[model samples]
Target: MSNIVSVFAQKCADYDEKNVQSAIDSLFAQMGGVAAVVPQNAKVFVKVNLVREMSPEKCGTTHPEVAVAVCKRLLTVTPNVTVGDSCAGMYNKGMLASVYAKCGMTAIEDRTAARLNQNFETGVADVNGKVLGKCEFTSAFLDADVVVNVTKLKTHSFTGYSGAVKNLFGLIPGMVKVEMHSRFPDLTAFCDLLCDVCEFARPKTVLNVIDAVWGMEGDGPTNGKPKFIGHLLASADPYALDAVAVSLFGDPRSMPVLQAAMKRGLLQDDLANIRFDFERWKAKRIDNFDAPPIDHTDFFGNQLAWINRLAKKHMVKRVHPDKTCRGCGKCAMHCPAKAITLVKRKAKVDQRKCIHCYCCQELCPFDAVRFRTSLLYKLARRFSGKRSKNT
Candidate 1:
């Protein structure tokens, strides 16, 4: 298999139909064209990163312009292209419509011949991986003859980085994802399960594309600053794609999912094997890219059990639902551990039952979720003024 990851210079605001489509056309051409991955008259499912009901400009979800551009390209090879994703919450048609409308996915149907995935049906897949044996997935993804993962690049509060591999977590469908978090509270194990899901879906996945034209930098998947990266990336291998994607901001090994993937022999820490314009892309790297404190969370994977406990106790950010919480009950409904409760029309977290999974923080629509570091962690960061260099 070829280890090349294609990179293209583009922007979110480059909404000119010809410019966007040409970039995508060139991107697919770099990897032997859409016809190479997509077969004639085959069913194609374009899985986008619709994390929640966020607009395209937020950089939280996949931009519809990119999705439309990609779907238009895929439609040349197959007329049966559908676009959709299972956001965090209830998995129903009503929820789907709301998310689709808010996230601007409705544009795909208007702009291209592709149809939006109306299939809310969920089914269990026999994913017999080390961490995940069986799990629920959206049937739209499973029933497709070919799957194209179009993901948004973001920094995750819990997982450190969200790229091609982390985007597949959306396939699990709604609140079931919250349950998985409670089941595997440890960062390493959760990331292992992520690897398991990716491996299970890897066979049908033909191409992985990252929307780095604009990406979130701090406290993301949902809430963060949208920075202009002005680039897009594609690869047949998700691992290699992520390895290159993460390198744009930080070390790939620092990402929990990538670390777990390497341990499972799915990827390597070194990027020497991946074929890309290294020096050219390296020049585009953002030196001040705001990223999560991954080093603090790496303690969860330490061999010493006490160190793990210590990290869990103090190193991790504590979830605090502030006064801004609008009593929407979304966090309570989606809390995997059932640790969040609404009292007096306000959300309250039972810390004793809290798994530190940060689901409440991630899915809160009101942006009311606040994370407070412990005194010990603060002191440590104070002493260590700057994070160690990635090299």
Candidate 2:
């Protein structure tokens, strides 16, 4: 219930057999005792950021060691601790098994009383929001007595940034998430959909944790370079935790999802409103953090269709299926807009239909999807950069 977003300095390497058991103790202690937050013998679901099936060292998913540490602590308070996530792709036992094994989440089950979630059932739930009325939700999470949001800090291509709130997006069943993207193509609306999902799940989410020991920098939630931030953050308020996380690399308000959160009064625009050691956390900020190069404007939010098209054609980034594509249909299969197709055994994108959601880039397994910035947009950015420097 505290607005305090606790920032703790801890390294990924520090999560070893010698210290892994108590790795995140200080983080929880700073907010309040870990025991005080979790209910006794409750069905606790530790929903983690398993965006796709990838190795943990890639920094695309939550680190197994960090998940294990949290699971160990939670098991002390609850016998029904489950660590899992509905990763991108199909929602089935086989997909879950593959993702858990590849992401090293299976280690959590091997080491502690916490068991991997085997349930893949999903059902409709009343979202009852401005954009989302009702949507599919993973029953494993919806039925939980308490939910612990364990997310990775990263720069997202579509959302601008990914943190605790965006992490909850995994609760929506796997491939059905692509449909949500199609349903809300506008970034503002998609972000609103995100807010709706979080607001619906907020009552059960007691703790929000971010694994910042190694965070993805560019074109992320998938492909990106791992940057060592050497910190772990936690708060009962997912919005406040995200605000602090976004400040590590850029202005929190600049993120479309965070902007939407503010619009709904779920978060405040001012960072000072949140409780924390401001001086200490500020000193830890990564001044040169590399964010995705795409324009973050919500052109789709514009009412005039022609104006939206014109702006999108000149200012937005374009997705290209490069030579490394291997003629794979992965991008086409997951593209929310269905803008991609197989041509001459290679993937090609229809710019007219493309929604710029970056689902193609995020879900492509071959790492073949690439982005190109518009010439006019580049020139405009150069001019803006010069003006800012002169001022």
Candidate 3:
């Protein structure tokens, strides 16, 4: 028999601490309280999704209210509580200060006794991972007795879904995350690395909470419109938490992160094994969730090289630099394919070199990287719209 994982959900229309506190407390209580995961005087760390230093309205980073709610409950178990995230920046006094200030993390310290993590020092853990044998992580992550992964529920361009599993990528500190994307450009390889990190941390991570109150749609993780989801989801098992979260849309197979986890035997697409009130959650399911278009895979590329290139060019969506490009050169710096370059003081992407991973699109702070579909691909989608909705 598969493990009976329990997940709970509470509708939160806003991020008000008073409104969210009771919901947070009730879900934890229903799931056996924080004591189930944290021991007395244990060091508890809350990992918030601070992808970049953006305002709360952007709905990119985990709201400060979520951190406050988690810390409020965590305090009952242990006084040594810390909340932080490894966003896309240098891990220094300047970087941490900017991210905390912009993303409202400093307020967490003021509201609760929990403090922000100041440790920039990283240590390597021998995961004996399938992809990379070793991984580098912040001391806060490795030293924490119990880690509560609080992630912003959003649509991702590459991974298809960014929930508990996608949130684990933050463990790989700083620009090194960009390096990993460059190393594993393919979604399958990249998700394997994510799963490896998730499996390594799964034992220590006590709980996973997803902030779906305001999830991003379209080009998410950074540049996307915020949609009011009104859901506060949690589970002791991160995979199960993710499994339930991804099912809100059309099909679990549409999301590569969930698909990859299923392929690795890390999780199942269905919640049959997960112990949750499926009937209650049905009422709250998002009917018209606007997820990004899925980039179809070229499985038969090996047969013919020229035909594969032609297929990719006309089929897969391409990332383009729009007028918003500030010539910051940030996109060029981290692009795995080395396809982008500054032209006439504006960033440009060489479609041929691009791999359609959307790393540049996700990492770009300016929302300058826009996705463009080929005319033939657009026509195909028009005709097949009814046949394949999520795809």
Alpha-carbon deviation at 330 in model 3, angstroms: 1.9
Ranking by lDDT: 1, 2, 3
- Model 3: how far is 170 from its true place, Å? 0.4
In model 1, where is the ten-residue run with the lowest total lDDT?
A: 1-10
Deviation (Å) of 44 in candidate 2 = 0.7
TM-score of each: 0.94, 0.92, 0.92
CA shift of 296, model 1, Å: 5.3
lDDT of 1 by residue, 8-48 (tens): 44433455667667778878877777788788988999999
**lDDT of all the models against the reference?**
0.82, 0.81, 0.80
How much is the lDDT of residue 230 in candidate 1? 76
In terms of TM-score, how similar is model 1 to the real structure? Answer: 0.94
Q: Quote the positional error of residue 61 for candidate 2 in Å.
A: 0.5
Clashing pairs in 1: none
**Stronger candidate by lDDT (1 vs 2):** 1
lDDT of 3 by residue, 295-360 (tens): 654424467566445655677778888997999988888787789999987999988788776877
